[model samples]
Target: MAWAILFLAGLCEVAWAVGLKFSEGFTKLLPSVFTVGFMLLSFWLLGLALRNLPLGTAYGVWVGIGAIGTAIAGIYLFDEPATLLKSVSLLLIVAGIAGLKLSSH
Candidate 1:
């Protein structure tokens, strides 16, 4: 199903994001390779999802989900900024994604 593929793509997005952090400016071999693979897989699934979902809606949701997911991972796993302001911003992104899904129906 397209939804399942999209969800997988989102997970890959998260993986690649963590990969990027470990990439050490792409000098690290394993993480760099994994990052490339995950990035390719994520985009491929996004393209497949776009075959049925509207481009504007699908792209927006895909990007929003990836951004929010990656930001949360960065904060919790990487000790990046986790301020209340960042939390509010992430919630806003989630709210927007929810709104998009609701309006699509």
Candidate 2:
């Protein structure tokens, strides 16, 4: 299904985002390669999903997923601050993504 592909793409977005931290400005060879690979795969999946999903809905959901996932990764992996406001904001993004999916045909 297109939604499933889109969801996978969103997950890839998260992987690549975390990969960037590991890549260290692309100075690390293995991590940089994996990051680039994930980036390409994520875009490719998005393209496939676009065949059936609306651009606005797909893009918004993809971005929301990446944002939320990366933020969580940062909090857990990098000791990034996890304030109350940040948590609430992430929840809001999740709600928006759910609303978008429900509203889409």
Candidate 3:
């Protein structure tokens, strides 16, 4: 359950990250508001998950999820480069997140 909440938080992190691009330095009103909202929700969910999960594992996984999701969003939405090295790096992050989960509990 904690892991599930942590995953949701990570997804919110991704939403806020992409939201930043849409917000345009917070100049856009609606996007900026959504961004701030997601940021708060992400933090709140993370706090809840922390009650049961180890800090190191939960934080690492959360960051890994955000990084991967944002990178994918950038590639798809923003026409960001999707080089081989970047793909491999994302895979490495996934591996690290998995390792942390396996090492925990």
Candidate 4:
């Protein structure tokens, strides 16, 4: 399904984002390779999803997934503060994503 593909693409976006952090400006060979590979795969999946899904909804959901995943990963992996404000903001993002999905019907 296009939705599944789009969600997978969003996960790949999160992978590439983490890879980029480990890449250290692309100086790290393995991380750089991982980042590049995932980047390509993410875009490829996104393009496939675009065949049937509306661009605004697909892109919005994709971005929302990446944003939420990256923020959580940053907190756990990089010791970023998980403050109440930040947590609430993330919840709001999730709510918006949910609203978008629900309204698409």
Error of 1 at 56 (Å): 0.9
lDDT of 1 by residue, 1-105 (tens): 776777677778888988999998899999999999999999999999888777777887888878988998998888997999999999999999888777777
TM-score of every model? 0.93, 0.97, 0.99, 0.96
Candidate 3, superposed: residue stretches over 4 Å from native = none
TM-score (C-alpha) between model 3 and the true structure: 0.99
**Residue-level lDDT tens digits of model 2 in 1-105:** 999999999999999999999999999999999999999999999999999999999999999999999999999999999999999999999999999999996
Better of 2 and 4 by lDDT: 2
Q: How many pairs of residues collide in each model?
A: 0, 0, 0, 0
Candidate 4: tens digits of C-alpha lDDT, residues 29-100: 999999999999999999999998888988999999999999999999999999999999999989988987
Residue 83, candidate 2: C-alpha displacement in angstroms: 0.8
**N/CA/C clash count, model 4:** 0
Quick one: ranking by lDDT, best first? 3, 2, 4, 1
Q: Which candidate leads the pack in TM-score?
A: 3
Model 4 pairs whose backbones collide: none
Q: Model 3, poorest ten-residue lDDT window?
A: 96-105
lDDT of each: 0.87, 0.97, 0.98, 0.94
Instruction: Please give the lDDT score for candidate 4.
Output: 0.94
TM-score winner between candidates 1 and 4? 4
**Inter-residue clash pairs, candidate 2:** none
